[model samples]
Target: MKINKEEKTPWICDKCNKELQLSEIKVVYLGGSFEVELMQCPECKMVLIDETLALGKMIEVEKGLEDK
Candidate 1:
């Protein structure tokens, strides 16, 4: 799944003080890995997983993987 920055509020990286950019990120779960677009810091490479995604698609994928 692709995650785009649709929110009006921009996310900033606290460590780098830089605005997060929408880019493809590699996510690993249960020994599975996939790439998806997400907000991340270009300099620090810090990825942001918002509450909505954590509770929604992330949870769904985790459950689906665990069931397998």
Candidate 2:
């Protein structure tokens, strides 16, 4: 239930017009941050957060925060 990690390698960045590289980036929500693997624009540092990661892990974290 995650984005195409292997299928979408060497992505083309929309902003920089450069090839996106697989890298680790930090995602922040509700004053918390966590590392996530993603294809990102190396030049402009734009991260492509997948729908599965957002709907799955991100939502779960938000819900956990609410319950705390």
The stretch of ten residues in a row with the least summed lDDT in candidate 1 is 27-36
Residue 26 lDDT in model 2? 81
lDDT of each residue in 1-68, candidate 2, tens digit only: 97876784567888789998889888888866788898889899888888998898898889889988
The number of the candidate with the highest lDDT is 1
**Model 1 residue 58 distance off true place after TM-score fit, in angstroms:** 2.3
Candidate 1 wrongly placed segments (more than 4 Å):
1-7
- Lowest-lDDT window of 10 residues in candidate 2? 2-11
lDDT of 1: 0.84
Candidate 1 lDDT, tens digit per residue, 1-68? 87667857778999999999999888886666667789999999999987886687777778888899
In model 2, the Cα lDDT at residue 41 comes to: 90
Q: Give candidate 2 misplaced runs (Cα > 4 Å).
A: 1-9
RMSD in angstroms, all models? Answer: 7.6, 6.3
Q: After superposition, how far is residue 53 of candidate 1 from its true place, in Å?
A: 2.0
